[model samples]
Every structure is written in C-alpha cells, then in structure tokens.
Target: MITVNAPYAVAVHEGNDFTANPPHTSIWGLLYAQVKQADGLDYRNILLNESEMKLKPKRKQDEIFSTFMQEAEERRAEDIRLNVRHPHKVDATAIMQDVMQQMTIEKHNDQSAFCVWSNKEVQEILELYGLPVDSSLSILCVEVFGQVNNTYEHIDDFAINKSSLIKNTEKEFGSEVALEYNRTIDVVGPQPPKRPIDPLNSHLGMHRILRTSPLTEVPFVCCTD
Candidate 1:
C-alpha cells in the first residue's frame, strides 16, 4: 500500500475517545516511509501485532485498561462488578463519561493531531474524493476488539449500536463538544473478514478542555508494533 511502503508514513489516531482515527479529508503530509516506519507495524499479524501487548500479556489488566479508555478502566469495571457504593458508582460513571466527553479532542490545526470515523473532514473526503476512510466506531472495534466483554455476542450488530453510543456521548457532553466525541470514535464492524489494513514495518494520546484535550499522547508505544 502507499502508506506502508512510504519513507516514513504512519497512521495515528488524533483523539482519545474510543473510535478516534484519521479523517479522510485532511491532507496528511507524512510520506509513505514515515507512515510505514511509524504506524506501519500496527496491524501486520494479528497474533503478533498490537493486540499481543494489549491482550495476551495480561488479558485482564489489558481489558480493564482499555474498557474505559484506560487508566480508570480497571476500577470502573470492578466497581460495576461489585456493585459497591451503587449511588456513588453511578455518579462516578456519569462524571467519568462527562469527563471523557470533555476530554475528546479534534483535529484541525497542525500541532500533530488524530482522525476518526464520521468526522466532517472524513465525510467531506468521502463525498468529495471517494476514499475509504474508517469511522471512529469501526476503528475502535478493530483495534480494541477484545477489550469489550461481549463483542462476539453481537459483533455483527456494532454498526447499528454504534450510532446509539454516538448519540449518548453527544448528549452526555452537550453540543459544543459533541462533535469531538463523534469525530474521535470509529465504528469498525459488520464483522467483515479481517484483511490487512496496513502492511508490515509500521506503527502508530490525551488531554482535557474537550477542546484542550491532546489525542496523540500515547501512554506506551510497544516496540513490536
């Protein structure tokens, strides 16, 4: 592919939300090499790729880390399981969701941002250029497949359900920031056959303000991917 073989091309998600990915419309300046060297190794071999670090090493820990957007995922999952402090837990979840909504970022400037599904930018590309760019919900399903508890039970139903998540997230954050949440999460599903999105030798963040949040701040970048 053009991106994988380029001198230094890399695919990076511009936001911190679940479906965040690159928009189709923004002109990416990175060369194929950079994308290949940087974001290339990401989806090479399913068993040996990003999922290896995110799942096999410590499945449970990884699950907790990813389920709620990391950092707070574990505690949130535990809280849900135990049903301890029900009122407080519910309140905390609301607060957390709100915080995350406020934390989702958008890609407009050149400070090095990310892209996602359904962004105005992507829709523009699809409408204007006819490129196939993934939506945030789809991308999230692709990258974090194992993180969700019942993905298999209804993996086929994600696209339909994803719209619901988008609406809920938008309502949670209010209008001013809803766009960012909508832009960050990609809904990758319909459970299509897994094909190589990007080729070998590649690679691939956060903040607050909803507007002020930084999406490229990756906690850990594995050497393998």
Candidate 2:
C-alpha cells in the first residue's frame, strides 16, 4: 500500500521515527570530514543532528574531543583488524623493490609512519607474482615489513598462552599427552607426494596425497587424475 524510494525507506526504518526523527547518511558526510581532518582544519567540529545535518555554531570542545576520540579509536581498531585502511594504487612489486633497495631507511619510514602492506595488498601481489619468488624469501620480505610497521599492536594486546592449548587434555591424559600435544602443534606435518609427469593427465596435474592400503605397506597417489 505504501512505496517510497530506497533512501526514504532506509531513513524511515533506521530512525526512531520517520516523521519526527530521521537518520543522516553520515558516511556520505565523511568525505567532507576527511578533507577537514586531513587538512588539520577540524576546528568547526560539525555535529550531526538526528537528521544528519550539521549542528549550527559548531560543537563545544568536550563534544568535539569526544567525537574525534571515538572516531580515532574506531579507525585504529579497524586498522589493526584490517592492517591497511586504504590500498595504494601504486605497483606493489615496484614499491617492494624500491623499499628493498632502501631497506635501512625504508624500515625506519615504515616504523615511524606505519607504511605496512594490507592483507589484501599482500594477497593480491603474491597471487600476481608469487610463482617466481621463493616462499622463504617471500616470508622474509613480509617479516621485515611487519617489523618496520609494528601493525599488530592491537592484536598483540591479547597474549595467548601455550599451556592453554592442552590444559583440558593434560588433566585427562597427564603430562605425556600434553607434551605430545605441544609437539603436534610445533612439529611440521608430512609433505605431499611429488606429482608424476603423466602426459596423459598433464592437464589434470595436482599435488597428490599419498595413501596406503589397509592390508599393505605400499603407498599410492590419491589425488586428481
């Protein structure tokens, strides 16, 4: 019986009352705030009403501080969880090469400015150019960047105890099982079998898993064609 635009619908449903109160699209207003915040001209401290319009005559110091602090805290939390808030459009490989060239100075820059790569950036670069690079070298590069950035401050706030892994198992099975549990966690598992060069199934090539028959000690390939 009643049909309005999507924006109107959102405004109505998201607010306390569509007629008396309405929610403002603060995200749209964020562009303006970003310009001000980045420009270091955030003196006005525009306060949004329930309808999202700027409150007149600017906000008080306490309100401005409170709002800015809350925003900063939220952004910091997001950066920790996400690693990178904004993805630079620059060529990552080229940047990595340049950074690697200026390793000493670049390391300092990363530490001071938090120039660490985001998870998305890392994944994207690796997917594009990972095949030629050795896995160890790739890991080392990331480690160096991580050390410089120290971006895990939020995640590191919570420490994980090694004992927590096997606490329950230790009670039930004693120290030996707990030691084994630790070993299992620390030890590397067996690697997959090398894929044979089967021209017949060349297109279907994959890292094959080794499996053994119940009655036999011999192993056979158990993956792909």
Scored by CA lDDT, what does every candidate get? 0.32, 0.31
lDDT of 1 at 44: 20
TM-score for each of the candidates:
0.17, 0.17
Model 2 scores a C-alpha lDDT of 0.31
Off by over 4 Å in 2: 1-65, 68-161, 188-225
lDDT of 1 by residue, 14-128 (tens): 7533322221111111211001224666532111111111111212433433454543555667877888675223344555555554434312222232322224543454445
> How much is the lDDT of residue 15 in candidate 1?
52
Q: Model 1 Cα RMSD, Å?
A: 20.4
lDDT of 2 at 97: 50
The weakest ten consecutive residues by lDDT in model 1 span 1-10
Summarize candidate 2's per-residue lDDT along 177-216 as a digit string, tens digits: 9989778655533333433232113322332322111211
Best by lDDT, which number?
A: 1
